[model samples]
Target: MAAEMSLVSVVLFIATGALVFFLLFLFAKRQIMRFALRSARKPHINIGADAPRELREEIQRRLTIVQSVRFEPTLLSEQVLEASKSVPNHYLHRMKALDAFTNAVDCLRSKDTTIGLRGTKQTMQLYLFTLCPSAANSSQAQIIDMFCSSYNHARHHPANFGNAELTNYMELLDKVIRMIKDNKKRRAAALYPAVETEVRLRRDCGKRESAETVRHTGKSNNLRLQARRNQPAASRPEHVEQFNMVDKSSGYSSTDHSSSGRGSVERLISPQHSFKPERDEAV
Candidate 1:
């Protein structure tokens, strides 16, 4: 009886130990499965869409404000030396502004919806401000004209565009204008004769071109007037007659004549006079 009891106790102990081991194994498996599930169920990173509407609008507003603040041509000329000295260092600031403008434009273009009128105007203003010269004085106009020509070349010509930089666009303009102004200041200097000669040549060329354009415009306008006049009074459309009458009323006179056996006509008109009648009639 004593031996049988001892054997029974030993069997019970072995069974208890086996049960504990099984429970531990089950717990470990459950924990491993939970860890794997957690690892597999991670959240994704979010890279949101383009700039928000509010931010874009704010940028556009700022751009408009910047555009309206016109630079004074006389002040710019007076401070040319100072601008030259500061430009190299402050170039990065200008570049940052340019980048902001570019990014804003990109955001504006990305949307399928039409930008509001205000937004469109602001964008155009920003583009002009960043890319065009300030409209302050006649000097500024000349600088702007040159800058525009350069910009067109840059856009169309790969070599020119490659050499172009934001700083180059901004600073070079001021530099060239300053150099011209400085040359004018030193007109009595030893280099004055050569510089004056170049200036005179440029001035003459500009005047000649302007005169040619005026002559061509006048000839074309005269031809148009003559054709309208030659139209039989019955064939003269009401609008054409009205237009001619308005032109005559507003200081524009048309003369029909014959030159070298060819019918020649002349029309003397001012743009202001031509447009004013139409505007007044509309109003």
Candidate 2:
């Protein structure tokens, strides 16, 4: 009996310990979830080094206002209506909102069409893109449908949005912004090598062309000089006058031995017979 009683007590203790441990686990899970939610809800602040201070401040201010605007838990939450009412009808605020929206869209590397879209239209476009990137290639009708549906839902069915819908959208926007910046960096990196290679190729080509030009010019100049050197001196204009004067001075005289003088002049003019061969074999 003592042994049975001890066994029962051990079982009870084990069960009690398990229940306590289960409760602690639940508590820990709850705390972890809460912390995660809080962290997600918190806004991240970053000022662009490239952006002007005023522009950065304006963006921050607008984002702050957007974060402050929270949807209610109920599906019938008039979140937009409430925000509209709470915020004054000041043109400055409207302008700020528009500016912030445009700037953020620009940051995302969006097309001119997307950037041109105003207010809720732009939001819908981005949201649709986030959901289905291929939707960008969809037909005009399909695109129109998506835009109309999003507009209708946001305007008429505020209750359909989750409590953290606005926050989620904001997060998505931030993610897209980062993605665009990363894409630009990657493209720039990829293009740098190509640009450098092209520049190097062009430089090499230019050098080759210049070298070839110089080589061709030198060859042509050398050929011209060789031609000039190979030219007959008698054909030269400078020696023509001297040849004429020699001819006039050495002209045949009837009083002298005309035949002999003519023969001598002919021999002087013709180098082929500079040395005459013996007509008779040693008389």
Candidate 3:
């Protein structure tokens, strides 16, 4: 009986050992799976369409603000007729555009020029290049170049910044803000076609007023000349009638200097001096 109990004890010990080993194996497997999941998994961030409504609206508003800002008389305007010469209408870079737009508005409104100034400076360079071909000579371009040099040195040679003073690029920031504001105003004005029409009407009215003034002045001068010639009042009408006559007179006949003075004055405004923005280039 003692031998039988000993065998049973051995069997029971082996079974308990097996159970413990199985439990240990399962625990180890669970631990390994947990580790793998933690290492391989990444936190998901909802963005774009998946982002919240408020976040989307804010982003849209910022984008619209930047889009409203325009650089007039740009290379785009000069070659507007040719599709081949067209520059794609878009911001310089996406991330940079967002940062700069936000910073510029903050800088102007809240006077916050702490962060995002670097991005703003770079955006200005893009703006200059797009708006004007002679961007290299612009004051903003010079400032940005200096900023780039300092930034590179500080980034690559950190030891050199120990005694170096932190450069203030707020002036360039100011320039960026100013340009954006000016552009916004210009674009806003352009939105109202009535404003342009009113301006044209005013210009036409001024031209008519000036012409009437010139005409009255010429009439008075002609009367003075007739009076000087001691012509009778009846003959004055004849002289006035002659002045009013068209160039349909005899061949190569000299025009009356006083009467034709308006045409001469008008001719002084040469076509060469007028603005002609069209360019000659095509595929």
Candidate 4:
């Protein structure tokens, strides 16, 4: 009986341990799922406020206002009324237009769905129209209008724009702004004649150097050719006449005979012997 009771106790202990493990596993799984859901709902935040110093300086330089009129902050607002005579109306109109556009874009990002969509579409259309206004109908305006319509449709149908879609749109907008700034920089560069002149001078100097190098190379080749022509040819041995003289007296050696031959011939053959016969010459 005691053995049977021990066995039953062992089975109960095992069952309790398994139940505890299963409960812990369930709790862990729930925590993991909650973390995943929270991560999915979180908005992406751009980190780090420090931008490259060069980029900041470039932005400041480009945005520097070019104004002939100076006014104090305290009295500027009131002075503006009096200064209206000097200030161009067109300039004021442009400022007001830019302000309106900025405000419209900000309003489009509001929490109210209907107002946000309507404001966004209207702001987009306004920006397009201002950029390109045509009596016939501007292509830029038409494109913006189409994009606005599509955005409105997408907003109403949430499935049309998931997280990826919104991310892509933001990326595209960033690229467009970057391209616009680049184009503005290029246009500014084009307007500066001093910069262009410096570039031209640098190019001209490079070309001049290349021409001088070519001229020097040609001169060197000509000098080398002239030097080759002025050089002398190899010297050859001098030619000497050979004469065969047989010696009747064996007392003289060949070297002695060779050396004495000229003197002996000169003594034996006189100017008179040339006109006389061989026997007379012998006598």
Among all candidates shown, the one with the greatest TM-score: 3
Give a tens-digit lDDT track for model 2, residues 167-276.
Answer: 22322333333333333433343233322111122236446532222111111113322343465657433312221221233423222346553422232222321222
Which residue pairs clash within candidate 3?
Answer: none
Write down the lDDT that model 2 would get. 0.40
Those runs of model 1 whose alpha carbons end farther than 4 Å from true positions after fitting are: 41-283
Runs of candidate 4 with Cα error greater than 4 angstroms are 1-6, 29-33, 40-97, 100-118, 121-283
Per-residue CA lDDT of model 1 for 1-283, tens digit only, reads: 9999999999999999999999999999999988887787543432222679887777667866985564311112225434644674323333322333333333333541222223334433233322222232223333444444454443334442322344334333333323332333232232223321111222464475322221111111133323533556575333222212212112211122224321111111112111111111222
**Model 1 poorest 10 in a row by lDDT:** 262-271
Which residue window of length 10 is worst by lDDT in model 4? 274-283
Looking at candidate 1, what is the lDDT of residue 66?
86
Model 3 misplaced regions, further than 4 Å: 1-28, 40-107, 110-174, 186-283
Residues 46-99, model 4: lDDT tens digits:
222266878777655654543323331221133553464487332332222223
Computed on alpha carbons, the lDDT of every model, listed in order, comes to 0.36, 0.40, 0.38, 0.36
Per-residue error for 48 in candidate 3, Å, reads 26
